[model samples]
Target: MTILIGCAHGTRDEQGQETIHRLVEDIRTALPGKEVREAYVDVHGPFVADVVAEVAAEESCSAVVVPLLLAGGYHVYHDIGEAVKDRADVVAAPALGPDPRLIDIVMDRIREAHIPDTATLILAAAGSSDPRSQADTEAAAEMLRARWSGPVRIGYAAGIHPTVDDAVADARANGEDFEVAVASFLLAPGFFQKRLTESGADHVTEPLAPHPRLVEIVLDRYRDAGGS
Candidate 1:
């Protein structure tokens, strides 16, 4: 049987871990009778290598690993890719990002934050050092700009230039009426989400996870991967 492995960039936050597990549970619930398991790429246990090895050992047990990340970078092209590379039974799915539906969620969260049209919108992502991740984020920001008429800017939480605080500060400095609001590009809450709240933006939206649409995205990735 082929199992669904929901692999995420793990977090040290206890609640973050719980939220991730809950998301995985929801994924399992969505695809009833399918065995969905959880693993991490960093910060916590059940690492991808071990998980894939375990599944590969079971006779005829194939698996699909769906990345819980919103963007592709080192984790996607290297870490997770390396874990499943030599194993034919393990087919790794694409990252969950650069999707229109995710932009929908960001807009939803922005509206939920109650920011007006005149305000400056900031697309805040937990950044990566990889240039590819930056390109991916820029593409996402372009998608967001397509929907919002006001100025949109990209900010990072870590490992990249223009931190969230700097972005928020710049937006605030634009003019007297500048109302800076941030649309979180993160999948789930953790250290970076907390940083966003402290970034001094007038308003900040919640993370993308704990939403039904994300579960749909994960399943879509899994199905798209096709069983081995």
Candidate 2:
């Protein structure tokens, strides 16, 4: 059977690590009798390249590296891409975002935060220098806007323009009468999540993992890349 490598941008936060581990376990449970493993593109390891090389060496075994990241960026195009590019038996799947179900999770988080309809919403992501990543984030914001009647804006935790702090400040300035809520576009708790919490918004939603829809997305990505 083909192996499913659930690769994530690793984190130092223990809870973040646990959250990602749980996601891999869920994928394993969802695809019984198949080999499922976890790898990382940064912070910690077994790193993606090492994992992919190992899988490639195994006879009769091909693998799909499904990014647990919310958007495509350096990690997706460089790290994960380089890991599988040399091996015919290993292929990489697309990042998980710009999907309706993830927007549903973001909306769920917004509602759980008790954010009012009048609140200006900022979709805050861990930014990347990659334009593709920025475009993916913008697409996600558009999706959120369609479902939400309130104003929606985009912000970044790092590596791009209009930091979350700035986004929140701008929203507060433009809509003095309205509260500013940040919808975290992150996958799990970590440094970025902490940054979002301190972004000066009236409220900030939780990260988008530990959700069943995420597991479904990972599975779909794996299958889309030709994983059995």
lDDT of 2 at 206: 96
The digit string of per-residue lDDT tens for model 2 on 4-68 reads: 99999999999999999999999999999999989999998999999998998888999999999
Tens digits of per-residue lDDT, candidate 1, 1-228, equal 779999999999887888898999999899887889899999987999999999999997899999999999999989899999989899899999888889999988988888898888889999999888888889899999999989999999988879999988877776736688988999888999999999988899999888899998898899889942
lDDT of 2: 0.93
Considering every candidate listed, which one attains the maximal lDDT? 2
Give candidate 1's TM-score.
Answer: 0.96
Give the C-alpha lDDT of model 1: 0.90
Highest TM-score among the candidates is held by which one?
2
TM-score of 2: 0.98
Pairs of residues clashing in candidate 2: none
RMSD of each: 1.3, 0.8
Model 2 lowest lDDT segment of ten: 170-179
TM-score of each: 0.96, 0.98
Off by over 4 Å in 1: none
